[model samples]
Target chain A: MQFERAVSVEHVQKNYGKFRAVDDLTFEVHGGEIFAMLGPNGSGKTTTIRMILDILKPDTGQIRVLGGPLTEATKMRIGYLPEERGLYRNVPVLDVMIYLGRLKGLSGDEARQRSLALLQQLELDEFSRKKVSELSKGMQQKVQFAVTVLHQPDLIIIDEPFSGLDPVNTLVIKRLLTDLRSRGCAIIMSTHQMQQVEEMADRLLMISNGQQKLYGSVQDIREQFALHAIIVEGQGDWGKLPGVVSVEPAANGNGHGADRALLRLDDQTAPGDVLAAIAASGDMHVRRFEEAVPGLNDIFIQVAEGAH
Target chain B: MKHLWIVARREYLTNLRRPSFLFAAFGVPLFMVGLMFLVTTLISNAEGDLDSLGNIGYVDRAGVIAAADAPFVPYADEAGAQQALQDGTIGAYFVLPADYVDSGEVTITSREGAPDSLKEAIDHLLLANLTPQAGDDALASRLEDPVTLTVRALDRGRDLEEDAAIGVIMLPVVFAVVFFISAQTTSSYLMSSVVEEKTNRMIEILITSVTPLELLFGKIVGLGVLGLTQLSIWLIAGALLLQSGQGVPALSGIELPLDLIVISLVYFLLAYLLFAAVMAGIGAVSNSEQESRQLAGVFTFVSVFPFFFFTTFLLNPNSPISVALTLFPLTAPLTSIIRLSLGALPVWQFVASLLLLGLTAALVIWMSARVFRWSLLLYGKRPTPRELWRVIRGTPMTAVGTAAQE
Candidate 1:
């Protein structure tokens, strides 16, 4: 299925004195997709988000949200959850949510009703009338999320969305994001959680030192960085195999015999060739054999190290 | 504009519902009422005690005056009067020497200061008794008050009514207090609100929905309205109290001129805007409430600097320092209001000062918006003076948009 663009950023650059915060950054987020912005601290992810939200204008770039420059009208269709998590600490949670919703163009009644439903859905109904300061950090995070999505924004940008959530609440938010995505809301989230991104993000852009290190679909990027190797479960002297250059024990400790090994292939060796050799040797019984795909966490470490 | 109103409404409601606002709005006036009641009661009780004192004894050695139907009892000699005073039969005693009329002096002995009413009674008794046999009641009255002067203003070609003179004397203080209260309350609110938003990093979320200008003006207008509401409540309550004859006695007969009232309100708004914008700018650059308040203190001091020169301005509205302060934007709102209250400010000066003040307020507001937008995302470190100048001059920070060359 074809997808329309929700946000397009081109050649965006932001500078703070001699320090360049973002450099020639270009990317696009499409409708009904989850786009993760992967970066370390001070990698200009927040600055890029601010530019997209039009909170800070890029010195030399164009950002089109909802097919046009950000304006007062366009802001209504966008929801933003900043990395800094805070609400009016002295105000009731429901009131803060409703106020934020109204700022996003919802009518008072609509804001209140939607906020009420969101609070209930998030299991925060009991604390709706409590001051924000009275809520726990995780609860406040949920409240912030509710406010972010209260007006049903067409595009949602959340920075560090699950920072303070526990395992259960994290799963809850993961489901919520997938639910929003299925409803055709475009989401651009920035987080340090590679596992979450690996599970959820359709595409991601990784930047380091204000420069793009990688960009593409998560699967494509992972495949491009995959090591040419296979994991085998059969017990054998895998390192002594003809095509095997090196053998490392698998960390999962799932070897059929005393050892499960990851056999690294030589330059010209194919994984199928290795499987045939393992079968022909018949010195070991094969329980499992599959190509090893690099996890996002490993890829992130590799790319970040390479950039430096 | 709609966003402005939305933000402003939130600010208004949020602050208006606070316990602090409610306490300030009602608690102060009630406290003042109770204080006034206590003071009046004490004063009246003291007066009653003084009036109940025993008759004073006097020794009239001059023999030219005799004690009549007064609070005094005559004694033949000083020794007898002293004895009566020591015996507590007389509350106090006065001795008149044989040459008292020529010396124009009398000695008094008392454990405490003589009451003013008792002294007046003695003066009346002496005047009545010393007059010649042909003297009439009219002559006795003339002796009490030898001369009386009535003042008339040549400019208006009429005598100044007692109440008008009193109004003239009281107007400056009234204007000063009103302006001080309104500006102090609203500007502090503006500063603290901005600091609060910035500290919590909510400014980032807010600016996404509204322009910094909208946010700033929203706070100013919202808090301005709140301050006006507070002032109105006080004014209405005071007026009611005055009409019921339960207000401060000194303010009972004072007339508040319509023009003065109108001018005072205009100055209140202008002064609030000027100071609020300055405070907002300070808040934008500050990282915490403590820092913001410290900076705000400077502006507050400058705004109230005119009050320190109150006597100078009231004594001579055209003094160079007074005129300079009245024209200087920071002090103009208060100084102009005070000059107008003195009932002597020239029309041209009034218009010029107001125009200068209004223009300055606009400029400050615009500058505040720019500063706020530029610095809203800045955290951890305060901007340097050069960066602040750049913001004020509309210079985009060179560090903000440069692409990282890899």
Candidate 2:
């Protein structure tokens, strides 16, 4: 059985005077799924997120988080890490975290306990007493992320979570997200990091120019971009297959006796048919034949470029 | 309520931790105290020369006026007095002509004209020595039946000595100085903090954690409490200095009513809130320090204008201008406290003034809350008063959500 919908947006539209920020947006974040909203800059990803948070009301359509109108109580169940990270600069890391936790209705002692635990998990326990400005940019961002999830909200929303982190910190946060997902938190992240989306996102929503261009499971989106390509380790004359559209030598090039070829299929042909046909060429030694699914980056570029 | 306290505690802690806040709280007061000490010492040590000092000689025609009882120096005759004065033996010579008691006129002979002080002393002496039989009705009334209005305050908690009066007079000035400093410094703190956060895009994290109202209230409460702490230290220092009698008179005899203290505290609280709210409103709309200062200028004026009315309030605390000033929330905290510290205020008037001030404070706070909610989201551009009013009327609901998260 499917888990309940943690967040649902039904044809929501937001307009700032004459400028439409989000237009006819509709999506759902299912429980325990890592749903990523993928978009280029100014594609209304933040705007849609704001609408979901009830920070900005939709001009049209409806939004429900956990099956009801958004209130302060509902907000307590949702953890948000905005694209622009901030804390009171003069306030210490621990104090700001506990203070944020308190807003979600955690008592001081409870907030302190949870915040310290989070800081430890983020490997920032040593600098908890330092002011936000005293910390390095990446360190402050980690502290901000810690504050966001200290209350362990059922739905976690992070915008541009890896915008400024070094590779190590990015891996740390990606691991944290994975851990959170395992514990049954519904994570909705918005980012231009297609690599992250490809690796972490289970479902994806692609928006272009304030309008929804694509929304589905990551596999489904890749399937929708049916420009099929396959990598084959066969030796000779693979480009001679009847339905093969194009052939490119793999990065190892043809110099190595053990080489691979990327075969593209025509619109009407299937990668399986091409693989079968290539296998019939006994002149080629076949070691591997695997169809390459479209990556999130490829899907994003294709959909966004398709829209414009 | 718990959330409010959490917010308030956060505000207080953050504010207390700020280097600028710490500096203003301790540095400004200590500087003022040092400056005042230096001023008092300078004035007390001011020197005078022979030219600046006054001297006089008396010629007593009436044998009744013995030489021992002479007001100034005694000379045998008018020529001798004139010769002595011209020869620099005296500053001025007084001629007590015949029937000087009845005439109440005394001639003075000198090379140079007597100064105002000597003239005043000569008149005083002539008046003091005059007989009662020769007294006019005004003189007899002034001497025989002086109207003595003894002050008896209803609530006698602390004595109001002359030094207390001095402190009382100084109270308005002190609070005015503090209000001035606080309004300038605190509002800038509020403004700069807001602007810096907005510019740096740090407000986004804050918005997720706290409501705009909570943030505004927290900041005001924190800064106001801090301001009061500084003020209390200054007041205690002042009280101690007066009591020590290093040169200033000690507080003695006059009592401070419980009602006055209560009213003063309440007024200060309300006034601080009013100012704080206005500053928050300014901070919300401000994208820069220069813009914040310009926006908060009106509040600064309201906070400091009471000092200009200090003279009038002292002369007649119950006068129409004083009454109006004391009833105004911005001025009431300082002016009303000054009035209460001095004698002769009716309880009802004090209560009425406080009530008015409280009501005004409430009104300003409510209005400021509306403005703050609307403006806090707007960044890179300041909202106009008209736009703020529109937000209050709910015309621009969309704008409310666009607040600067920082």
Candidate 3:
């Protein structure tokens, strides 16, 4: 089944006096996809999310959620987990979750059942009746996450969802996001963590200083910043080969009984030609050969630094 | 509307279950009853002690008294009365002057201080002996009661009944106190709740589900209901206690004016909205609960300040100061109620004051909504006066990035 656009922001400009928080930003998140919004602190990621949620209106732009303007009904189908985490500290975890779910348009029984099931799935069922203040930070974060998803919203927006979670819980959330996406939910996440973005994001928009620096599919972005070279393993002293501009030892410490070397090709050299040459070199043994693609972290740093 | 109800229900239920609400709702009346009991017991013991005193001896030199009352025993001479007092045969002795009726002079000698009951008994006995005989039925009826003065109001052209007069004088103050207590409690709760939500960032989640106006109105209605609950408990307890014949003596016989009660409720709601909006605005701009409370203190002082001039207001609700207070939005709730209770407020004045209060309340609520929406995510520092003014004037807050520049 083809899913419609979950969110579309067009020519959105938000300013606080003389400073621009989001400048002519345009993006779209389709259903069944995890779209990551990557930005540094104070980079207007939250402001953009708030605008999408209708908590703040854009100074000059239009935002469509679920293929229409954000009405209360549309808001009911959207879930948001804010960066600044909060719940009623004195209220029981299940009760808070149920309250939030009800606010999102769930019936009392439905909210309760969903909250309980979510708690059980998240391994928080034992603490369901405990006050939120009594829970650990991670537990509280899980409860907040449960509240965000309890109503089975079609679009879920989470900011810094993994800030306080440990590795196990992070994996838990990652799996949940994947599961949600598979079930046709559009998830937009804002975070500074590039590794998580790389692992989960189908497409991403990276902003710096409230302006878009990079946006595209994760694979496409990585390919755009690719080193135009091949990485070869297995004892290669390949600097002497024709069409080789430079060769550097790869820093990756994969102990696969071979030394890795990065081979940068000249402008006229094709990757097939380099492979043919490496094959012709009888003294050299090649175990692995592949194009060198940049990781999201490196791309993020390069793009951010280049923008600055 | 549904979101508003959900938020309001949550607030009402959560607050109702709090220990503080329970303690305040039940503990205050119990405390009042205990205090009344203590005072009544002390007064009764004192009167009991006074009544147990022995009889007093009296000496009449010019025969002002034909015979002494039961609590008094007449002596033949002053020397005999003094001997009886010295011998402890009487608690004390009273000596009447030779021209007692003309001079109205008497002397009492006692080991202890004068007892009021004994003195009153002796004075009554002497007065009975000094009365002149009536010659006819009409003169005797006139002698029984010398004079009577009836009071009438010139403006209303009617005699004020005793209970109505008392109600007129006291109801305003009662209403004012009740309004102050109820509005103060609810408004303070509104402020603290806003501050708490903002500080905890729960508002961010809430606003996503409902508009800021909904949240504000929901909270106000919820806490208003809580305040009404508390007031109902107090009124019912007071009524029951009064019916049981153990209520406060000063309030026992006073009748509640229905008109005043209705007007007071209206004033309470308006005043609550006005003050609660002001407090919620302060809460939105404040970065901390302490800061919000400090700002709320100014408004609370303004609301209660009229009570200091309670007597002046009651005496002349038409006085310039009283009129000004009644007309001013901040002081009108209490002052107008007081004036209306005193039967001095004209219809035009009442209408004008209500209009002013209602408009001001609407304006405050609008400003509070603007401020709350703009400042819900702000932290670390309170908004500057200029920023607050801009918000109140409907200037959109610069987005987060630009806020740092300001």
Candidate 4:
């Protein structure tokens, strides 16, 4: 179901009276990619998502969803999981799913079959006849995610996909999203949960107060904001090493490596040179050694606060 | 169009099973039929009045009676007649005034009420007093107490069937009641359905799948069909009642113009379109059920505003207020149906009312679609009238300060 281009928003601006909700924003999501939209609470990420889904119209720009404007026919090819997600609480789970799937242009049998399969995959088949309100929050979140992808939409936009999920369920959803992406789906996911974005998103965009603060591939953006430092875990006297200006505990989590440390280099030092020096030091045996790059969480915090 | 149909089907099916819809659909016809049976049974029983008024007492203020008889007991004064009435000497009394011969006016009072026997005795007494040959005149008059009522239509050159005339007059009232109840029930269902979707945040999910226009029309058409289902049941019940009610004399006779039922149905559609559109807009703009009701109340007030002046329309049919309500889309359905039922409304008023009602309903639906689209995603405090107006005017009101589900 790959289209020419999944979505292209050009110079989009949306305002509610004097307050600009989005301003001159431009971006595109192509097939077979996960684009993370990172922002704090009320940071226009949801607004931007709605704009792309054609739920909200941009004031002064053109948004071509699924190659052209988001028409009734094209709307079927897109899916959305809003932050304030909901299903018909009183309706049976499978019925609700089928209704939504049918609304998205799926045939009844196709929707029912797909819904049952998704429910089974998510281990929710037993609750298919139960009311949605009867499900636990985590279970409901899984159901919501299932509903989003039930129609196999070409362009999927999800907000806070893993907000209230346990690690196991989160992994399940993450894998599902990844699988969708592998099948040439263009997914735009918005969240403040930076770890998931770093793990799953190929490229990311950060918006605050309706303006784009950052937009690039996950690795390139991380490296762009990377510090001139290396992290060394295991037994090491890293503070006394040559070209080492300082030594401190790693604020960013470095996993279960023994005795972790983040080594800051001087202005004239190279990260490769520092790593070579660490290896030459006979006094140290390192478990993990890598150049330091700031996580998306820190960058998100910095950008959101800076915008304020 | 397919999406619209899907949405409509979902709405229709989902609400069809609602308790309120079921009750309105089935309960109303049963209730109306039961009421008709009860009322007609009582009216038929009432026609069997008591045969005698027992020992008639008269004040005889005119002193016209020469002497008292067994049935006729003359009292000297008004006090005597009252005393006699209280003492159980008489079951009822009548006062023939002092100028009885000249004016020929007689008044009667009875605790047993004026039964036919007492009334006929008085007629005899009057004929005997006024005529010298009292016995023959009284006997001749008593054989037949003559009066008759007959309705004839000169245009058709035939006497009206008593049942059909009654039916013609009663059709509008029946229609008005059913329509008023059904419209309020179904339109509110549409409103609350919209509000529920908004409250549960399901609008966001639906808006993505279908256009707002599709969403609005789907719901209106779906619930309109629901209303029609209810009306169909009532119509069947009504036909059953009309067929059976002809045998019950108190139900009288009915002659309904086929055009009346057809016109009522036409007005029902127009009324529903206007009402459902307004209600859908209210639901979209409101954040809660109470808010939806509060906003919906404005239309309720407008629709019923004509009722206060209903008599004016019935009397004049061309009064300003009457014409205004007949043309006003919200008030037109019941107003026109009722007035048209009474007699022929002028052709111009009928045509203009239909045209205006239809045009206004169409216009309101257009505005409601705009309002529905703009307001479905909005949350927090309800939007003000001015804000709603701006949205209706095609201004994009992005929900900025409010949480746009962020």
Candidate 5:
């Protein structure tokens, strides 16, 4: 059972005075999936992640990682990236990274070697001797991220990992995260970047105001917020289609030219029937005939707003 | 413990590598040697010259007093003395007014900002002159030829090296101050380190593979080694200084008791551990360096109070105030060690104080460890002294982390 779930946060709660930062959040991160906790700022995502790391105690409920109680032994199996990124500012980047890696039981030489290898791979080898304070924020963030993974724990939790990154750096981190996931590590990340969630998250948990608003696969969430959108481009009017709920003009250029209207379906009509109805309008050519799947972003907005 | 070693090793290396500790360790001794050289040069110049004493004047109405014995030149009248004093022609004046014969009065008149040493010397000379005139001729004759008895201790053990031991013990006390300061200053570095980790939210990642207690213990133990390392070097330098320097007269008849050295080591370790544990607790509860400083006020007060009352202890080590302070757990380690070094201690009091101090240290460790366990995870705020007790009684320990001991 422990092997089945890499991290299980069961009805965990944390309160600071009267404010419940994490209120009865119950979720399980599977052993090999990249699960994401999606939320806006101050929504308790980091609080929940910290509880799993055992840096904080829940006022109530239990948390188990790698199938057992949180102990020194269990801690070896997890890596974490905190929301506020920092390292020892006065120390050299390599020294700080290796020192932090040493805290996780790596030998000094081994940590040093690994730190060099990681820095080189991240194209940060030249700056290893530079003080952390001298590095750019984006570069420092990368170094901190490397420190987090230096010991190579089986489960990695990253809070706002792509925050404050340029698009290129963000892409680099996205690929690195993908690579880690492919290695069969159970990676759970909390981020505000919805695009990263669409690209990487296999499953997700969305919470707001310390309550779970959505929890499931991307496909399931999108289906839950399903909307019918069709692209039509013929002389026949889009309004003439039977059971059509609404028709809105969409982008007409960029290869799919001229007449394009996105058609929304009413409740009782199948997308096939709408396709058949569009077929019945012989004067019009239906360039695209498919149900518009709501993305994680759309689902995020719909479900998050619904919760409020 | 291994984790603690790793942390300690890092702390020691980091501090040792820093230019500040290096300056304190090697540079300070060089600075001290330079200062001593300057002192010796001043002494040599003062001994070689008479004019350096500056023009000094005195008026003595007592006709029996001779000019040769006086510290200043004797003037015939107050007018010449007053003029020299005010014009800065003479450094200062010692006046023996006529009324002084009946009342034994002496007054020093100096220009504003006259050298303080000259004024002090005049007062001492005037007092010595009045002593002989305190009685009639018969009593006065006895004062000149009074019987003097030579004093000696019952056991003249280690008499030759007694003066050196004064410097030796002073080394430890000075080392203790430096130790108390450095240990405390660096230990707050640990507290600040922890507070920074907490505030930056980096602690969330750290505790995943190491317990907060382990981290706390590691920091204290690491910084403690750095302190001890610095102390050992300072001790060696102090011993060297005593061996080479001119003798100190006050320390000529003193000897350190053998038990003092043995008791010092034992008490220093116990006291350090107790204080370290308490500091870790404070560090755990504090969320900022500013908050940590405020929390550390108690430790600072305890460490400094010993230095303030040191003279009183030196005067009478067995006085009620000394005995009471030496038995108090917070002060006993430093005070008791000083007392033991000064002379042979009464065995019963020493043993009783040790027992009381040892128990208090143990109790302090347990209490501090409890506070550390409960409060390390409570971030974004600093706990009050009262809140810490409530945390110790029955606070939750569950949510801190799933630490995997690698």
Candidate 6:
């Protein structure tokens, strides 16, 4: 199982001037899993990613990729999508992808074939011959994503992988990432979007101000921060409920044939009591009722606010 | 190594397609060839000249000519020669005063312009009349082509022709300028390349793919080969010029100065490596292309500083100042080539200069690679010189940099 490690970073620290950008960062991303790095702006996520890719050297500690120090061969097996995005603007989309693929040790013919296949897969086939500058920002981002995965790397480290995409395109990329993960590709993604991670990531590391705030499975993290509340679907004025302290409106409501409400319970109010009262009132039909397991967004906000 | 070649080949091919590089590589040489063709045609035509001096009229007041050669229509007086000229019986006429022996002056008047052959014909006539060996063809021809001086430098064992001497002296200077100009242009491309990658933020992607040293060396060789390609085109143009000069009398006796060209090319390779390496560092440190060029000018000015002292170097190739410049890597390329041209270079000095140049080139490249690594991801602000120095001294960074050996 140790051989399954794609990235191993141990107590890595980086500093610019007196400010420590990444502090004692330690984690491992193994094959066949999606590991998400969660951080706010300036929380050292980019710094940590750069150090892992061997772009910026850490002040101390060790980082091993693909079970050892990065070699040219190791670099070839790892694809990175950097936070500061760019491609050769004047080069055609397919040509840029081929050049990048060749840099990773792919043959020209292999790179060409792979690039064409990826362009078609991403629905960007028509833009293959167009200059990258001609593509819209979202389209270019998708192309960048294609370039990242074209080489079929064992490990893919993408910063903000789904930023700047509409829901459809975002879903398209998410499906692709999920597929790669399913095929035993270790994916390390750095993002500020907690819901995205909650939906996709198997395990996660949350950092704030260069320190690790949390590290665990997505379910474990959500359960760890599970609120004393119940989500009531097809609901009434939950604010007036007996045990309820607050009611917050949530999504997938009206248009989905039901209205959703999160019922916050005060101390000493059991969730069983709330359900009993909902049953007693014939005024509202209770379709779904469950103790609320906090979404990653709630956990992220709580952790971030707690750190501050 | 494979990565470096991939980078270099890509760099070469990419820039090879640019119109600017194409124009620089081939256009300049073609233009020079065209200019040379024009000048050579004019010179050969001027020298390979008119059929005859035509009929002549003479008023020999000094009575030195015992008789007249063919078409020599001699008149007894200036009035008679002027009458014959007006009547168009003689193409031109000369009046030699009675004291021609003292003054050696001849007055000539004609409707038709006097060509150079006419003057030569007149001089030959006067020589045949006045000189005792006038009838001897060998002696007369000897007088016609008087002096072709060749000086042998006893110490150097090389001969200098009087006419080709200036060319030999200026050859090093011309070579130095041509080489540096190409170096400047190609290395500037290197600078822009580095800065562009950084500014465009593509370097982060690249740095992840290749080591900083590989990146630096790849770019240097890539653009260095581009300059070499340009130099090669110029060399072929030069060879063509020399070949075309085979039949042009004006170009005959001028040799290619092979020794100087070979040594200059050697120096150019070393110097270009050093210059391009430094420029790559400047590019990495600078946040913008404009800023990089501003920094580049300092090193370029130093590298070309030797050109300004060419006369001093040529006149005293063995002088202490010349020796210092030759030993200094930045100036060594031009100054040593000058000293070699002057035939004043000791084998030891030549060897030492090359050793120093090669060492300096290695040192600068190593230093630039360090700077490249440190500054590649740094943006919006430049590192202070002290910060740069500390990076060069090498911070105790952990694994995954050039810190780990290949």
In angstroms, give how far residue B207 of model 2 lies from its true place: 3.3
Q: Give, for candidate 1 chain A, the lowest lDDT window spanning 10 residues.
A: A251-260
Docking class of 2: acceptable
- In model 6 chain A, where is the ten-residue run with the lowest total lDDT? A249-258
- For model 3, what is the error of residue A53's alpha carbon versus the real structure, in angstroms, after optimal superposition? 2.0
Off by over 4 Å in 1: A1-3, A15-20, A239-245, A252-258, A266-283, B50-59, B70-114, B127-171, B244-249, B399-406
**Where is the poorest 10-residue window by lDDT in model 2 chain B?**
B248-257
Better of 3 and 6 by TM-score: 3
**TM-score of each model, paired residue for residue:** 0.88, 0.78, 0.87, 0.81, 0.78, 0.86
DockQ rank, highest first?
1, 4, 3, 6, 5, 2
Model 2 pairs in collision: B158-B255, B158-B256, B159-B254, B159-B255, B160-B254, B160-B255, B203-B405, B203-B406, B377-B403, B377-B404
Instruction: Report fnat in order of the candidates.
Output: 0.62, 0.45, 0.64, 0.72, 0.55, 0.49
Error of 4 at A167 (Å): 2.8
- When 1 and 4 are scored with DockQ, the better candidate is 1
After best superposition, candidate 5 residue B340: deviation in angstroms? 2.4
After TM-score superposition, the amount by which residue A288's alpha carbon in candidate 1 deviates from its true location, in angstroms, is 3.6
Best by TM-score: 1
Model 4, retained fraction of real contacts?
0.72
lDDT of 5 by residue, A203-243 (tens): 99999888888888876887777676665665567787888
Per-prediction tally of clashes: 12, 10, 2, 5, 16, 0
Per-residue lDDT of model 4, residues B225-260, tens digit only: 888888888887887887888767545466455777
Interface RMSD of 6: 6.9
Instruction: Give the chain A TM-score for each candidate.
Output: 0.93, 0.90, 0.95, 0.93, 0.90, 0.86
Write the residue-wise lDDT of candidate 5 on B1-406 in tens digits: 7777777787778877778778887777778777766766765554434345466787877653443343467888989888776776776667776677687676766654345456545544544454655324455444554654332222222222333544545644654565455555566666666667766655656666666567777777777777677766765675565455553333333333444445665766666766666666677777677877886887768756767777776555567878777778777776666655544345666777788877876777677777766655566555656766665675542333212100
DockQ (C-alpha based) per candidate is 0.52, 0.29, 0.47, 0.48, 0.31, 0.40
User: Worst 10-residue stretch by lDDT in candidate 3 chain A?
Assistant: A251-260
Model 2 CA deviation exceeding 4 Å by range: A1-3, A233-235, A245-262, A266-269, A285-288, B19-168, B175-202, B250-257, B316-324, B339-356, B401-406
